[model samples]
Target: MGITKTLNDDLIANRSEVSIAEFEASRRLGAREGVGGAASWAVWGNENDDLTIFEDSAAISPRLRKDVVLIGANFGLGGDTGEFPPFKNFHARKSGGDSKLRKAITGTALEGAFLTDIVKDYPTKDAKGLPTEIKSGTLDTNRYVLSGFKTEQEALGLSRDTLYIPMGDTTRILWDLLVDRGVIPAEQRVFHRAYGNGPLFKERPVTYLRHYAGAVDMVQAVQGLLAQLNLR
Candidate 1:
């Protein structure tokens, strides 16, 4: 139940508490809530795209209880204020990005599955800007980001059988990069072999779909994809 088990050692070592006024100041600038799931663990960012994890309370170690994982592009906004303020869980909104994602997973195997984003803290209105922002960071920092990602995955208890659902092309691209960098762990490289799962993801255990942040019928689209992969 200690943060030492859920976060990277370096992050835990650097974490601290902020004043009430400082926390409110960040929220006014559009800082939102934490990641969704049993434990409210969130990886948030700032205007600069520096990422960090925030958790309200410690839960069991490696809380990934399912074989399916939902991967997103990045946390929308909010900088690292070192404050664990309460906010809506990931994809909990009824419209726009959150609604689209919420509808897609409803009544499917993906519902309540473990969800996360590739880029942690950098917030951008359009994910298209992600590439430039990601490239803006130093090589060592980016590599550290991947190392942190690997740390989170291991902390969450993800293994080879885990099927990652990339929310869109952007997410897929980032996830692929992580894999190439060996951030996804070599043993967990099994791809979905179902016939209709598409040759695009033929080499990875990823089911592709358009980003819910756009104007797409994510529910039907994702359901169809999941059905094709025998996850319905």
Candidate 2:
């Protein structure tokens, strides 16, 4: 079925996750320390480009594993053409790819999965400026961003077994960089972006999809991803 607004609404209603209001309150408190600070990153919300890292309201036992982690490239907060600009929390306005992503994960193992971006506060319309940001030293992937990512992972209680789904090539590249830097183990960079059966891809811990804003059959793509991750 094609993604619909009602699907997004129903999905939002059904999930017992942290609310935007509560998260915004947390963000406000964190912002006093600094935007994108270690504490803010650890919170289940976006620090800069309003993304939602929905944590279930019910307290999770420390021993229980969070099965999935969905990673995006960065917050695309710039551009006048944005359909749903962030309000208080970056993901407060769920339109375009945000809504598409939420809808696609419905009924799948990824439902209620923790969502975040590798690069925080680097707001652009897309990944076009990522290379520039990194090369110019304005964005520190290792010392800054990676640390925040680790903090978030630790806060979420994510383990190596957590199935990571980086949203696009940009995210995939960053994910690989993290793997190389020893932030993430090399073995965890399991599947190629194309995702096919081959000796090179005979492992687990990571899989990916096209960016939600790009041309993609969201439903079919996620269904295929579920099979790839054995979440079927």
Candidate 3:
């Protein structure tokens, strides 16, 4: 039989090994100073546009509103009639592929930081106009992931006036529980802007939450994570 990419023995053998290798290399670090800095937490997300965003009048502050509008304008925000925009940098630290492994390790560090400590959830309303806790308040950053975005830089449009949190395993667990309880359907649990490996939406939890947070932030984190892989 002719060989195909998936049918190759070497490719399959190497895939599992790569994951384990990543895990082992991460372990050698013992602990990482993840998430507190822009570089650390940024990897929790990947690129996309089409996240839910509020107009300047709806979100929190004027300065943020100004930033949002300006950023959006740069992207031709609402015009919906322009060529795709250029890649803008967030001034973050990391870049490159292998971001998944780096983000996972960084997450380990964040969980350790949050253990036994409960952070306050700033209140925000859901689509139902009912009060919803922003949740994961313990991450100590006002940022949360923005769903329904269409591009990585598009995340910036959501951040100008509202806080976003990068969703983590913890928050994802919370979302699952919400689904199980029928609080919302499993489909509602994710933002449906980009296609995953297939037609399904991919759930990437990294997000920009603080003023320093954005698409640029995620790119930086990815860079930092890839850099760490050099040790392995």
By lDDT, who's the top model here? 2
Candidate 2: minimum summed lDDT over ten consecutive residues — where? 33-42
Model 1 TM-score relative to the real fold: 0.57
Kindly report which residue stretches of model 2 are placed more than 4 angstroms away from their true locations once superposed: 1-56, 59-65, 78-94, 181-207, 229-232
**Overall local distance difference test of candidate 3:** 0.22
Better of 1 and 2 by lDDT: 2
Clashes of each: 3, 2, 26
TM-score per prediction, in order, is 0.57, 0.60, 0.21
Q: What is the lDDT of residue 229 in candidate 2?
A: 24
Stretches of candidate 3 above 4 Å error? 1-166, 189-194, 198-217, 220-232
On TM-score, the stronger of 2 and 3 is 2
Whole-model lDDT for model 2 versus the true structure?
0.49
lDDT of 1: 0.45
